[model samples]
Target: MHHALAFLALSQLKGFGPARLNLLLQQCEPDGDDFYADCLRYLPQIPGLNAQQVQLCCQRIHNPFHGEWKERDQLLHWLAYDQHQVLTLGHADYPELLQQIADPPLMLYLAGNAELLHQPQLAIVGSRKPTIEGFNDARRFAGALSELGWCITSGLAEGIDAAAHQGCLQANGKTLAVLGTGIDRVYPRSNQPLYEQIYYQGLLISEFPLGTAPRGHNFPKRNRIVAGLSVGVLVVEAALKSGSLISARLACESGREVFAIPGSIHQAQYKGCHQLIKQGAKLTETIQDIHEELAHWLQLPESYSSSSFGLTTDSSHFSSNGLLSAKDSLPAVGAFSTAKNQQAVASNQSLELFTGHSHSADPSSSNMASTPDAYNPNLTAVAIKQKAPSVPKFDNPQQEQLWQAIAQGAGNLDALVMATGFNTGEISQNLLMLELSGRVVQEAGIYRVNLSV
Candidate 1:
């Protein structure tokens, strides 16, 4: 790595942040040997990136931050810290668009194939609680864009974000996943598989350092990176109250094209897209529109010619390793399943986990209501809140008794399970079955009886 890359890597540490480090690094020669020696004099002028933090970073180095011993040691240790790579703004590997942004990340932590960064890319963003159709749209658009040589970029979130990555991968395209957490952590835990896939195929990037976990504030920070990496962005589906719209607006501020796919007049998800269309977002329906809009930069025919490429839809989806395997073994496309029922699951931890029901909530039903019939419909994120867990089954007498205890609120599930004196296997199986039957509800990590008759 170059000196700038090393300096930037050290700067990614806990206290040696980009903005402050940039200001500090400028005080010394960009290629000077005395850079570390000059550090102590400049330490007094820096703010936000405290001296102690610098001391911590320098300590690992032999010389340390020149009398800011701790700073030097920490910087040294930071310099030694591996696993992540740092790309400077002027580096050939740095994305030119990102460097031009209002606040480009001085040091980028990239964990995938660097070549993906070279491809022209489009941003695809939408609600974390997108509908199945919304997910399908994101995937299809991303896949199509990928085929057009556009790398896909998005926040590594659930719903629309994952859908976009999955789509690009299905088309055997490149992608980039920016996260709100450290490269080591995957938020929502359920997205682990998707995260792994993207890390292996596309690129995983973050402005945050190696150990940062998700904070509510970290996400908005991440959104900027998504907008910065792409030439334009498309909003597939989002509600008026969604963050994807925030990203789309950011893309606009960055001088990138903003496009939205219109939805039904009656859908809440459509509102954000419609609002953007009115705000001058290009209304897009097909990949051709995006390719056409970006023609000068993306380069291509005004319209796709059969000679440019024929649309070939086969079972050529990629498996875990980022390669298209045999046609017969591909898993079903994310679009085949409707999110209408997906809301019925969440956390992947819930024995009765329901993201939302397969059907939308009655909206007319009270919080404590139960299904008049054993079968209630699916739910929607309508992302942060989770539905009550499902009661999987009540077929056995011992299991039924434990279920009764859980529903009646005799105690929490753990306590009831203990009191009812049931084995964990039987208990979990019964609970999951009850959830699937819609007879029980789990929420706030607690299980309750659906009381409304």
Candidate 2:
């Protein structure tokens, strides 16, 4: 208890982030019956610490109990609950992967299953304002990956992060939610139910002191922990400037695999993913793609086999140079043909844990609500029965006419608009929908039929 208090005191010191704290600890080597006495004696002589840092350390050591004991008290109160723990750096239960990061949290406040800290984790992150398709993809991927015995980790933010957590839980799999605020606080109050579920069934982790409110800057700092705790980080969808992209960059810097899902070229939401792919991040289409990359790190169950999931190990999806092929075909059209079908697949594929939900920033009926009947398990299989589109089909005569015009000689958007007599918006929307549905491909402002579709 005394040692814990001393460590807590050091953690409370101003301006002493993990990196500087670690360096100071190494230099001072504070030890003995009176740890504060040792700190006061040795901290001043530490070579790398600036004068202000040394002064802060001196002040902390001189009056260790000066400030509020609220943080320590709250930690103790929380610890009295079942399965709650505090994992300090170098502790036996501290995760080795996190410890390897450049600036690992000095301590983590953990609730629920502590053993899960040692389990393999894959981080899933993306835009807080994800598209409906992006939300479903996150849930589906998380569910499938969790079934393989991998724990899913994410910041307890909305959108893709929430979907990933719920998906894992639906599979009766473990998950971890790292927080930007205190462990006791759940940001975006809408996720209160999810917060409780994870606290009891999986784990809730935070580096923030008890009662810390959610701050904008804390999330980027929080992103590092999300990446640090996992073997890899999977970005489902994100804009060019997003916290998800920050996590991906941090994952790469830490020597962890970074995976991204491609989205329609027309959507600004997908630009970050395209950028990541261009920067050498792996482009993942299916759970099998991720499984192939992390197979060595995973411990499969006795019943687990490649054949169980009908996963193909062939690398044809990727180029000979190991990157995703530039000419790689888009996802099958059946995956995104209708909103109903997308909802069915998202719900049934992941067992309805996060069915028909959207956490977009601008929440509205159009973006957040889905058909109430879409949760039927058989509906997903039925919806996918349609043969993959070999030749793109359009229900609207205008879209069909526009597509035919493009297929013939009118390849550019302007030419298509002129040939079909449709307005520019109509042509652009049709082209985008076709590209998203895997029937059309756009290159250099020219549209072409996807022959491989």
Candidate 3:
């Protein structure tokens, strides 16, 4: 919370950017595996920290953020209100994918289902201006995927993205809406209904401070969240340089999968999808294509072997782009995926960390390595199908702690550990065993007892 307030104060300043703030953080924030906030005695020198900018903003001349308790307290008040909360990367509550982003939001303001941020998410994105076919394509894809229990994620824009959310909801699936504006302000005005529904059904998340307006620049930053939260981002319809294309780029940069639906050869709308396919984005014509991709990805043998990709077994290294690398050479992080696309009036922006389920997937698919029931297909979303009452089974001390924590209303892993007085390692093992038994379900980052338990 302290760091969140400090970040907000810096964000409110006019000249600060990710680069400059990163400099400040490296010098002043927590070090190594420890990530916590402490009071600053003086403003540390950020290579490009602007003195004039601080002065203009009424910050202390030498100690720009010194003793800014009143302002911090005000931010605390906002956090305490309904539809207001904040989370940061590296913390237990923060989304794991956001940590993989090139430039992530330091402090995000979340308006709903703060828990969903920790769940698994998929990003569905496309051009704001799309053809009628694009809209149908987006909705159908989202609905099919949601029916399989995937959380639909998207920027709450007017066209393809909006349709994606509607489809997810119709499938009784969960969705997340990420925004360029503050959590309280719905941009474009036309998406207000979707926005409200997401607030009630899934979640609405943002990096912009409370009451921040939707300016022209925030969308680019918003795109990062759209791409960052998902296992992958799917482009429904886009121009070569459309905002949705930016999301695909961001997804690539973050090492997430990029999928594109092919459009008609004669249509201008298909150009971007075709371009992406040619450039190596996965060609996604059906949900099964995605499922197969995930299944293949999960089936990778732990032992790295280039022969799996048709490369010579004697190969010592891979192409500069890693296309021919040994299977084990692929970074461990690229294994998971996000199934993007859900058509609804709303798109969920919530991101959260999952300690237990992060390594698992729905059992119905062979792609999931950990176990069949290790995770909920809609783990990252809040599917409103009456939130089926779950009963968790506990065969170990760790599993027992997980249930104890939930029974006490501790909604996150950290809280569960604190409440159970157990180390994360032991607790996680217990949770994993419980999940594999299908007695428990992991959502976002929290664990709950499934009805079978």
Total backbone collisions for each predicted model: 52, 0, 32
- Superposed on all Cα atoms, the candidates' RMSDs to the truth, in angstroms, are 14.1, 13.8, 17.1
| TM-score of candidate 2 to 2 decimals | 0.67
Encode model 2's per-residue lDDT on 132-157: one tens digit a residue: 56765776678767766689999978
Compose the digit string of candidate 3's lDDT tens values, residues 338-447: 32222111112111111111221222333323323333433322221224445444566567657655543343344455567778688777777776886666543334
TM-score of each: 0.60, 0.67, 0.60
Looking at model 1, report the run of 10 residues with the lowest lDDT sum.
346-355
Q: Give the RMSD in angstroms, all C-alphas superposed, for model 2.
A: 13.8
Which tens-of-lDDT digit does each residue in 332-396 have in candidate 1? Answer: 22322344222212101111111121221222332422324332212112110233444444567
Model 1 TM-score, all chains together: 0.60
User: Scored by CA lDDT, what does every candidate get?
Assistant: 0.62, 0.70, 0.62
Where does the lowest 10-residue lDDT sum fall in candidate 3? 345-354
**Which segments of model 2 are wrong by more than 4 Å?**
27-40, 47-68, 301-305, 314-453
Can you give the lDDT of residue 392 in candidate 1? 47
